[model samples]
Every structure is written in C-alpha cells, then in structure tokens.
Target chain A: MSAPPTPPDPTSDAAMTRRSFLRGTAAFGGLTALAASLAPLRELSDFSSTEQFLQKYYKEMTPSDMAKVIARIEREVQHQYGVRPHVRDLKPMDGVEFVYCLNLTRCIGCRKCVHACVAENNQSRNPEIQYIRVLKMPHGSMDVEKGDHNYKDAQVPDKGFFYMPVQCQQCKNPPCVKVCPVNATWQEKDGITVIDYDWCIGCRYCEAACPYFARRFNFTKPEIPKDRLNPEMAYLGNRPRKMGVMEKCHFCIQRTRAGKYPACLEVCPVGARKFGNILDPESEVSHILREKRVFIQLKEEMGTSPRFYYYFDK
Target chain B: MDPRPTRPGNSKSSRTNLWLGGLTVGFLGLAGLFLAGTRSPRPARADIPPVDKKFLETTPWRQTYADLVKAKEDLSDYDCYGCHEKNKPPPIRFDDKGKIIIPKEHANIVMGHGSHDRNDLCYNCHNEQNLETLQVRDGRQVKFDNIPLLCGSCHGPTLRDWDAGAHGRTSGFWDRKLGEAQRLSCANCHNPHSPRIPPREPAPGPHTLHETTPPAQPGH
Candidate 1:
C-alpha cells in the first residue's frame, strides 16, 4: 500500500453515533445466540432435509430410482439396527385382489394372530405397536363399542362372549388414501393400501380418516431390540419405519407377494382366519362370500367397500 | 458203445434224472409267474391284525388345522383292540334304571355327543365286531380318516358348508397352482365327544394411547 490510510474522525457528521454503535453490537450478539440455540434444529435439518426433499412420490418413482432408495434404506436400517435388512419393492401380482374372511363362530378369542402380526411386521417393541385387535363381544351383539378388547380371561370365547378380531380392511374405497395431503398412501393393484414411510409428512390425516382405527403413528423413533427386528422387510410394508410417520398392516406384503399366507392367517390355531384372491371364483374367500351369509364390518352407512368379510355357518 | 461197456440201466437213469430236473425248474417258474400275476396278500396270521380293507379304501379329508394335524395324541397309541381282541364286550351296560354305565376303562371319557343318551347307541357309530373301525348308519365300516362321512350322514348342511369352503378353515394356498389348499376335518376343531369348542386365554390386546372404551360424552 502507498501509505497507511488516515483514520476517519469520530466527530465527523458521517460517523456512527454511540447509540448506533451499541445497537450494532447488540444485533450481532442476538444473532450469535440464536445460531447457538438453534444448533440442534440445524443438525436435524441437515440429517433429514436433503434425503426427504429428494424422495419422489412412490408412484412417480422409476424402477432404478426405487432400487436406489431401497438400497439406501437397507444401509440406514443396517446402521441403526446392526442387522442387514432385505428391503424389497415388490409389485402386486396380476389378477390378484386379496380378501380376508374371519369366522366369528370359529374365533376362539385367542390372539395368536395379533402377536404373529407384530412379530412379522417388525413393529416397535418398546412402544408396542400391534395391528390386530380382537374384541370380546357379547354373544348376541355385533356392536364394536359394547365389545371389550382388554378382556383377560383364563380361556377365550368367554362363557357368554364371542370374539371378533379386526384389522385393516384394505378397502376398495379407502378414505385414508383420499385424505393424505402428501399422497403418501395409495391402493396397490392387488387392492392393498400402502404408505411410503419416507414421504409421509406426519400430519396424521390418514389416521383420523381411517374408520377401522387401523393406522398407527410413530410419535418417537421406534425402538426395537436388535434380535427382535424382522430382517425380511418390504419397502412399503414392514420395513423399519422412521419417526413421525404412519404405518398399518399391509397384509404382510413381504411374505404375501412371494405367494405366502399372511402371518395372521398362518398363526390362527383354530383355523378361523382365511385369506385368498377374491378375483378367482374358486378361491376360499369367494366361496365363502357366495355360499355363506358373509357381511362386511360396519357396512350400514360408511361404504368403504372393505375386502374383509366376517361370516358364520348358516 | 460196445467198448465202453455201459450198464443197461444207464440210459433209463439219465432219462429219469433229466425229467426230475425239468420238473423242479417248471415248478419254480410256475411259482414265480403266480407271484408276478397277483400281489401277495398281507399275511393274515393270528398275531398280526387283519388289514382293514375299508381303511385302505378311504381317503381322509385334508386337515388344515396344523395344530390338530400335528397333535401329539395318536389314536394308535390307545390300542382299542388291546381289550376287545378276545372279548366281545357289549358297547354299553345298563343299570336297573336303564341308565348307561361306562365300563371301568372308559370311565374317564365324558359322553355329551348330540342326543347320544336317548336315540343313539355306541354300536351305531362304533363297529360291533371291530372296535377300531367306525360304522356308518348303513352298517358300512368307515376308517378313522373318513370320520367326516360318518359325521356327514347326520350333519348334512354342515358337511355341505365344509365342502364349499365356508364353514371350516382352508389353509396353505389360494392358488392351487402355487400350493395345496387343505380343508380341516370336523375332529380338527371340535371334540368328537363334546363337539363344542371351549375358550382359551387370548393374546395381549392392542396398546393404543386410548383404550377401546367408547369415547366419553362431552357433558359426561
């Protein structure tokens, strides 16, 4: 430099006043405190924002994009659970419209199906998320309100009660899919309603809209023991769901898409549960609906057109 | 020939030996042909029980209940023939009041079958001579596996429902191409004696934030 520039005079008309100087200092200090206070929020934003913003809607994603996302999820699950999860994006089988039938007369009020669902779905163990709820109803009543779910009996089919187990109806006219603001949930070709865990904004609109009370929300980061985490996970079904997302029974999509029965159907000791493709006339569900006097749950007014049917021998 | 000085009986003996050998081989060939033509019936010795032809002919309805199919208690273990082999014991003995008295060995069993006390007798279902086999109303012996036919004779509607895959459980596969669908037999779910399904402890109920009780009214 040619020479040191002469300093400006403090008393000059253009110079800062003492009030202005103090105001500047205070403003700088306030901004510093805010940045420090919001440090955790910034960390959260960094962790989620990039991946979440990049995530495309489930139906909008291409095959390669879905593969990449599945691989990423596999890595994340492995990092968290210390177990390598087989996360797959299985499409629905052709000409398959699945239906479930529960025989109210045969149901012994045993909840083996409930436990089997939890285990197969890799639900949160600490918070205890279960998809199936068996209601102990009075012998003559079909009212769900009068039914007690918390009945602790020495044996089931209580002396004067009949057991009814309820789960996701997998409706053809699903209200939950309609109310999702983010389009996180939709009906698959096989008539299964599935939610994309990553895309859900945690608004719980679908949870509120569900008539059967089938949806579950992940309020906190779900904690599952390493040993208890089901490694065979489906991308849109039983994969390790993150915090602030919604989940429900997807009819064990991981297993069912591979031509296996749902966990609930497999575990029913009394042979009370039945599942099959409704499109086929010879399928068990179709046979039950055709021959037996089968009725859908809550079919009076709310026409969800549920695939689940409850029937007894006439 | 003259030089050899053969004995006069040599030619006759050779012919006799040849005939004997031919007869032995022909007998063995005939026995082999008989065995090949007909399957040898299982030996019906006194020590070995006779094969139940009815049992061999009957095919059991597919059992879908895995638990019942895998049940530990097997009928063979009971050995019904153990006591009934030599003694043709009467199926039931009546007291002076005409009440059926179970024999000492069967005292532990409770008989609550449908109208069994009045209209039915043990011989109606149980074969009189062969206690191991069940009998249809027409007196045809039915195997244990074909118990549905015996039950179907009375429960026509239920059998129809069972056949149509409405009343009982069908497990395994929806698509027959993928796997076999098994329909459960009556004995799989119901006790043949009591025929009524009993209750058992349920699995843990749902753990929702709110219980399943009806929501409280605003004023209440």
Candidate 2:
C-alpha cells in the first residue's frame, strides 16, 4: 500500500526567498568568471605530474631508481615526440680529468662546432639555443674586449680577425655549482660540472654566478622537431630538458665518458679543438700543456682554474 | 530461350575459349621476352657517375702520405722510376723567372709552398739517388709513408710542436686506456705544395628570439 502523502518540507520552496536565489546566482556567476579567467594557464606546458613531483634527487636515487627514471623519461619522450629516445645516466670514469685546448691559430671562425653542438644536444630550435659562441677577435689585440660575435663575413678567418669558440670551461672552482640553492648542480669526481634538471628550482642563481656566460635558461617550453630529436641522450648532458631549467655544456659527457670525442671536437673542420684527459701524461692535452706556449685562461684573475686553455702558435 | 543443338567448334563457349587461349599465349610471349631482355647485367649504376660529394665538406679532402700508400700497393701510382731512367737522376730545369718549371706530367701540382718560391724544387724532399725514397736535409732516407719525417726536417719547430700535440688535429679517444687515439699527419691537413689554410664559408650564426636589438657580443 502507498504510504500516506507526506507533506513537503517548508524549506524546499516556501523558504526560498527571491533575494536568497539572487545571491546564490551571483556567487555561481562569480565562480564561473574566475574559472574562465584561469583558462590561459592551460597553455603552460611545464605542468608536473604526480610521479615527477615525487622523484628523488639525482644523488639520492639508487641504480634501480635510476633505471626506472630513465625508462620513465624514455616513455615521456616517446609520448611527446613520437620517437623513443635512448636515455642513459653515464657515470664519470675513474682516474680521468678532461681538459680542452683550443689552438687559436687554426680556428677560422667557422661556426660548425656551434651548430653541431646544437644538433647533438637536442637544444631548442625555435628560440634557438647554442652551447658554443664563436667570437671574432681583431688581429693586433689579444684582448677579447675587442672581439665581435656578429661578424657576417661571407668567408671566415677574415684578414684582420681570428675566431674563438668558447663553451663551458669545466672549471676547478666552478661558481655555477656553488650558487645552486637547491644543490641541484655539482662537480663530479672527474671535474665535470653537471646539473640535475629535475631538482633545479629555477632560481637562476647559477646563471648569474657563471662568469663565462655558459649557462642558458629556457624561458619557455623547448620546441624540438620530431625528426631533429637526438635519439642518444644523457641524464646530465644532452637529454631534453624541461622549461625553467638551466643547461650548459657538460664537456659532452655522454660521448666523452664512453671513450668518444666531443661532438664539437669531431665537427671542427680545422681541428682547432683538442680534448683529452689531463691526468694521462701521454695524452694530447698533456702534451699541449707541457710544450705549448702562451696558455691563457679566459679570466685568470677570476681564479676559476678552467680546464679549457687557449694558446697562440708563436 | 530458343533451344537448339549448336555445332561444337563454332559454339559461343568454344569461341570464348579460343580467345582466352590466344590472349594467354600473347601475354606469356611478352613476359618471356621481358625476362630475356633483363637477364644480362649491363653495368650496375653505369648512368650515375661518382659525385664529388664536396658540397658538405667543410675541410679539404684527406690526401695524407699514409692514405696514398694504403690506396695503392708498391706505390705504382707515384712510381717516378716507372717512366724515368733508373740509373740517371731526373734533370731539373728552371724557367726564365728562376722558377722551377714543373714538368707537364706534374702540372697538376702548384708550386707556391714557401715565400719567394724557395721550396719549389722537387729534389728538396725527393731523394735524387733513389726515386722510391725521400731524403731529409740531413741526408737520411725515408719512405713515402714517412713523409712527416721528411717534412719535419725543414719544419723542425713545427714538428716539435706537432709531436707535443700543439699543432694539427688529434681525434678518437681522449683516454688511451679506453680506446685508440689518432693524430693526423702534416699532409692530412696542409697541402705539401701549399701549406696555407684556405678561407671557408662560415656556418650560419645564431638566430636570436628578439631580432630588434643586436646580439650580445661574446667576450672570450
């Protein structure tokens, strides 16, 4: 049997005042407008997932954790770029100290190394990031202050100019590593200064501290074409970095640690670039240090003790 | 609808069969002719001549003395004694301007090595007694592969710098324990006839985001 007809609660309709309904509608309208105003944030590409947020610091992660992290990175890269990347976390070798020596005489101001580094490192293409900067210095002056970065000569090694390709010097006393508030960047045992991109807070202190102007900051999401993405990547080196992270040359840690020459050194047409372990006395860098004359650090007074040295052929 | 007893050969089905048989034979004959025509190989890629492939080359071609030796055994390509008299030394002739007249055979080579044509003489490096060997200024005989020693005789300081890793290009591994490191010879980079490094077109410069202002001058 149907129950006796229950009386409607007074608050259901009788208690709803016109003024109360108007107030409720105003509140709902305000919330909708606020949410609509936040639509631009949907375009921000650097939104972190739960997994990314909970990832451990580079030093704290164990071998198993690193493997999982690398797998995750590969999966993310594949999802974003439609290409599976070979990402690795290469450790620095024992009893090795890499040093770079640039022969000032041989460099013809050709910017091959600059573009090669960009291609090898998976650097951004649109807002165009490059690791190496080739300077055109005047013939008579040894001072770099007289150098020009934007010499648009049809042929290189212009009669009165010399080229100097500069990147991260991997200094013994790196100021970039020192200024990291989050301890995201540090110098390895092999003297290579590296950054943990995930751990960086993007304060850009390191960028300010870098004396050589080596550090590059990503103002927006890096736009890498699917075809141009380098399949080979390193966790601390050439791996694709996210927005708001700082990146710089790590001496091509991916290749050098695997007993291969840096991309910049390999692509230099004139062979102005020289890279080898300074620890090995028989290495080319050692020979250059022992015999070459007029070895000049970019800023000796800064006392960075850079691993990179430039010399003139007297 | 009209039922009638038809003759076997002139029947529509037999006529169609004949047409099908003729078509099959004609197709088979054409296919057999095509197969026979392609059976003999007429030089693979004969139409495509070897491209110079120098468009992308930033540096000059590698023509090292060692490479020359590896390319041809017994050095028949550079056999000076193959044409000249084995016992007699090749005669040296000079033009009116005191410039050594390189023979028509060696016209491919340009002689402008040193200033004032001081090193235009072929005998300066080539051994006069044995055409197969090279002689340094100190009268020590060297082989074709050992052109560095021959070059080092006059370029003593440059040789010392090269040995010490101050000159030329060194490639391969940085650590000897890890892998092999190769140091290029003098001829690998510089032409023996003309040691000067030629000018090259520079790679494209950086394209900055903001094109309004000039780029920051790099100080290095």
Candidate 3:
C-alpha cells in the first residue's frame, strides 16, 4: 500500500517479510499462504512481455543463485503437476572435456531419444526443445539429410531416407561465441558453450551464427506443463528457460557431472548416441573418435572446431 | 500489488476488511502448517491389506507398477491402504533365534548380474543411513543417486568390474569401445530378493554320471 517498502531489498537475497520467511522454511508443514500466493497454479501458457519481466535469464540472475532457482522450479512444478520435479545441478566438468558422437547408421528415426532429451533437460512443452535433431538422410546421398531439420508436413519417407540427429557440438572453437554482440554467450573451460539468457538482448545473432544450427530462441515465454516437466534442472543449460531468450543443447552437463550418462545416450533405443570426456584418453568418446573414422559436421569450410563426431558402419 | 480501485465506495471499511482478510488467512495458514509439522512420522506399513487375511494369496498379480505386484481383484480397481503399505511385500521370512535370514532363493535371484558373480544382496553396501538424504549443490538439493546403491558388500571384484566396465550392464545397449565405462546398478541385472542359479552343465551322452574328470597332472 505504501510503495510496499521496496520489499525491503529481500534482505541479502535470503530474508524476506518475516511472515513469508517463516512460512517457506516451514514449507514441509505446508506454508499454505506462501504456497497459495506464489504458486500462480494456473495453466501458465501465456508468454507475454509481462512474463519476460519476471523471467531473468542465466546472466542477469546472481544472488538467489542456483538453489533458490531450483526451489522456485520445484514449487512451480508441485503446484502445477502435483508432482515434485527435480532440477539437477548441471555444471561443467573439471579437466573433463565434454564430447558427443552419433552413430548415424544406427539411428532409425524413432524419436525415443528426443522424448528422453525433453524429459531429462526439462525443456518446455508445446514447441519442445529437441536437443538432437533426427533428420531422414537420403540414401547414398548425404546431401539430403544435411539440410535444416525444420521440415514440415508429415515427414514420410520419399525414397531412401535415413535419420540423422544433429545437436550442439560443444565445439572447441564455437563461432557462435565470436558472433555475440554482447558477451552473453561464452565457452566454459570444460569445452562447452553456454548462453546467459538474462544477458541476451534477444538479438538472435548466436542462433544464426552457429554453423550446426544448434542455438534456439524462446519466441514466447516457454511454458512447461507441470506433468511433463523434468525435475533434474541444470544451472546454465536447461533450467526452466524464459521467454525472449536464446538457448541450445548443453550436453546434459548436470547428468555428466554426477557420473551419469546423458539422458539421450541412456535412452537411445538403438544406442545411437555416445558421450564422454575428450581430455581423458580413457573416456569412451575419446577412444571412439580416435579409433573410428569419424566425420565432423561441415568439416571443410566453417572450421568452428565442433566437439561432435559422427560415423556409420559400412 | 497496487490497488487500482475498480469501484468507488468506502474510505475506511474496505481497507479495514482487506487487512482483516489478510490476517485471517495468515492465521489459518500458519495454524494448519503447525499441525502438520507436529504430526508423527507415518508408520510405513499402514497401507497394505492385513497379511493375516488371505489378501496377498487371493489377489492376482498386477504388473502395472513394476515395483509392486498384488494378488487381488480390487488391485485393478483400488485399495486406499495399498499406498500406505509402500507396496512392500511382507518381509519374506525369519530364521532361528529370530534373526531374519537371507533366503537361498534370494542368492539365486539375479536381476541381471549374470555378467558378474550373482550372489550380492541389497544390503551389502546399503545401510540405514544415506537413504532419501538430499545433497545440496549449486543451490539445489538433488538425490545421492537415482537407483538404490547396494551389492558392493562382499563382491569387491564385481564392484570394480561395474565401475571400470569389465562387467555389468550399461544403461542402454552394448558397444565395444564405450561399453567398458558406463556402469549400472546391481538391481538392473539381478533380482535381490529372489535370485536364480547358473544352470548345471548337461551330463555327457544324456546318460549316467560315468564321465570322469581329467586326472590332475602335477605340472604341465
């Protein structure tokens, strides 16, 4: 009523109005007012500019940090889906370079990996993020599937269509990094590139600049149905992305940090995906890329130096 | 929230009502929360139908929830108590002197540990501690691991096999290069409570046990 006293600056990002503060700590006992006030509990699909105001991308958000971010996500999920979704801690590996590989020959166009990726990364529903694109390549002609993945109109087989899934290369020298007008997107020491969504001005330069077409923009405030949301959230990668921002595949950093394989690699029905640390010579991905005759996406020209490698058995 | 006052009415009554409403809601909310916190830790097995009754035997197995299979017609329908039970089938059996013994059937029960020596049980490494505890990282509290950790007790050989990938299942399919590193849980392969033994080698000639072992030579 009286300028709401500026919400008292949130008292160092932890303390709040004593009423709400005590209520959240007592959430296990059901802080009914806090739950009722914050849950919003509606089908929050309308991605208006109003939502963009509330949604801060990774770069802008600092204090309430990853824990509060996850807590907010869990509360939202619990309110919407009646299930507690877990947001995982997706952090870059230390001295462990993340790399991905696809067996283009084995991928059979079955979208099990896509569904797995959607669930594991906690991407929004209704225009879900397919971290890996499985395009139907023309037989004996790599040129057919080499085009963009956004082909519409019930992609039935024309003649000899083979599926090829494309995703972020976690490139060694990512061009998208160079193209950023603002220093919003940067590569981590672990060889993975990340975009601070808050810092991004929605300029979409990184999306266009990526040679592999790995980056995606949030045209709307992305709405994840509580039921469909994956709880395991990462910090920079798939942590409930906001509207009017750009995002891309993060190689499931959270899962990898915890000594677990990426969700897509785990759920591939045909074992089409492989992931590991490239720096570790003993890592599976390193051995595969070293031993196998692997093909890089656009090996000749762009020279972005992507970490992703592909091969198919003859 | 700024009050844009849709209707022009009261100078004092509406404001008083708003504050009163806020206080009333806050009081009730806090009261309910306090009641919930003070409630006792729930008794685990309060849900399953009584074992004394022929409920388990009469109920036909339902495969809906992989963790649970009940033998009852109402299972397809519903039983409110089933959830309280946590679907824990009655603790299998006890031994002499009241110490609950691991069943021999459990020894043979390998969920899929054939790739390893299939004798490990659930509690080999798992104890009372560390279950359901949350590890806070990056301001988030995730679990220790998804699958229940166990079977590392007496089978150190298998543990290393699992960690380094000489043996044990990967989460998905087998690969020659990547196969050795991605590890899996002991339960992914073998059933802990009821396990199976390796089949005996067939007798020679489908006849008697007349086949003799090769003589033990002193040194080859």
Best by TM-score: 2
Can you write out model 1's per-residue Cα lDDT over A143-250, one digit (the tens) per residue? 787777777677767677788888899998999999999888999999999998888999999999998989999875666778767899898889887678999999
lDDT by residue (tens digit), candidate 3, B1-220: 2233455666565665556556666656766665555464533221211112121121112122223332332333223233324334324354574434565633543333333534233333222133232222222332323323234433555454345432333453223243433444454444444332222211011011123433332121
lDDT of 3: 0.54
The local distance difference test score of each candidate is: 0.73, 0.78, 0.54
Model 1 Cα RMSD, 1 decimal? 34.9
Decreasing lDDT order of the candidates: 2, 1, 3
Candidate that beats the other on lDDT, 2 or 3, i.e. the better one = 2
Candidate DockQ values, in order, are 0.12, 0.16, 0.02
Q: Candidate 1 at A62: error in angstroms?
A: 2.3
Task: Give per-residue CA lDDT, model 1, range B26-124, as digits (tens).
Answer: 544554555444454533322312222231121332232334446654445346876666457565777897766777878665666776445336786
Model 2 bad stretches (over 4 Å)? A1-48, B1-60, B68-85, B213-220
Worst 10 residues of 1 chain A by lDDT: A38-47
| RMSD of each predicted structure | 34.9, 20.8, 25.0
Worst 10 residues of 1 chain B by lDDT: B49-58
- Which stretches of model 3 miss by more than 4 angstroms? A1-90, A144-159, B1-169, B172-220
Order by TM-score, highest first: 2, 1, 3
Q: Which 10-residue window of candidate 2 chain A scores lowest in summed lDDT?
A: A38-47
